[model samples]
Target: MEATPQAPSPLEETQRSGLALGLVVWVFSLLGVLGALYARWAWTPHSVTVEGASIQHLFDVILAIILVAFVLVHLLLGYFIVRYRARGSESALYFPHHTALEVTYTAVPAVVMVALSVAGILLWSRVHAAPPPDAFVVEVRGEQFGWSARYPGPDGKLGRVDNRIQRPFNVDPEDPAGRDDVTSPEIYLVVNRPNRILLRTRDVQHSFWVPAFRLKKDLLPGATTELVLTPTQRGEFDLACAELCGVGHYTMAGKVRVVTQQEFDRWLRQQGRR
Candidate 1:
């Protein structure tokens, strides 16, 4: 006796195609997630400030949780897709929502969100609070394409700045405190010392950023901003306007050199007191 063969049914054909599509999606998603993780780990910059280090640590903690969750979810999804995949002549099961499962999902995410918020606020408070009373002071005014820095003279006090005093550039020449201020093309500070920087803008808006210190603050027209930092490393770090201010935004660049107290004093003297 010989056996007879029959063609696949429409249902079987649909099931076959669905499984193929599921496998392709799973493979591509896994690859994409892995590639992103590797790239992020490869080129992150090193932090030179204690505050930046703390922030980076928090970021790492969050990233680790995210990566683990990502891998687990994708794996579980792939497993279910294959384990309970559609088959010809199979009847679907009816299932209803479970209150316990729903509550678990909602409560877990809410708790995680609250924890992250509290941690961020605590970290911000440590870094953004008032600077030490004896902290070194510096003033920075950003223009369309350049940065002008001022250091308090012997009196150790910055002058009262009135942006309206001058148009393109600002000053109150008669404000005696400002008369002896020293100007520098780039900002400089003493390593391991708290620094209070009073930021101003000459024309439009700009951002004063120090990547190594993880510090960035906007410089608004006719408004003053204060930024505090305590650099723990001695090195020349790059600064740039994080905001787009004008046609020269791409060329807007500055550098901050964190040096020893002796070197900072020497640098101020070289600039010549006004």
Candidate 2:
């Protein structure tokens, strides 16, 4: 009698099971993408919430393109691989690059990239442009594990601050700026005014990050850095220490309260008097 055709062995069966699992995972991933798209569409904030959220439209456009491209490419590749897997007497055919295909790929990506770059530059310029003449200035000082903020007391001029001459809570007697400029740990800002933060650190490198405003800047020891932000929303936001300093890094946090101009003035006066 002729030999019966051999059935797939246990090893082959196991291989098939793994392949099936991989396909199932890919399918679930696709479903997850759909769910994410729905969530993003439903949850995207129309009114900008943070400084970075001002460019939310641009970000959404870029993200949509990336997500769609990824899903399409993966699905097509997986389908082709499964449909054209190796079989007896069949071989794979490779095609050389076509100039039209190459040009289309390169030009499309180049255009998209250029558009994104231009949008980014425009947004950056808008964000960095000098504030209006009526903008407010607040001096921000970063130390080992805490943040202190100082506002110009009614004069709109920050008097002076020298770390070496100034004590923890006391101003120096000799230096003019130190004598006049006062520092306070409680930071208060007025709503509807452009605010500029002059950031400085005393001990080590630290980053002052405010998530609600989407503003962050690194404060270097012995040097001053600056950040300008406008709080459109009036509320409270937690300040996170973006950089690692030492043992208490995890506990280093601050509170930011955006209040009405009247409320801010009241608080400033109360804090400064003490």
Worst 10 residues of 2 by lDDT: 43-52
Give lDDT: candidate 1, residue 252.
91
Instruction: For candidate 2, write residues 156-270 as lDDT tens digits.
Output: 6666556675565334556454444556777766666787888877788899887556557898877778877777778777887899988888887998777888897777777
**Candidate 1 clashes between residue pairs 3 or more apart in a chain or in different chains:** none
Model 1 ranges with Cα > 4 A deviation: 1-19, 167-169
- How high is each candidate's TM-score? 0.89, 0.82
Which candidate number maximizes TM-score?
1
Candidate 1 local Cα displacement, residue 168, angstroms: 8.9
lDDT for each residue of candidate 1 in 150-236, tens digit (9 for 90 to 100): 888877877777766762235577778876677778788888988888888888999999877887999988898989888899999
Candidate 2 local Cα displacement, residue 200, angstroms: 1.0
Q: Kindly provide the TM-score of model 1 when superposed on the true structure, using C-alpha atoms.
A: 0.89
**Superposed Cα deviation of residue 222, candidate 1 (Å):** 0.8
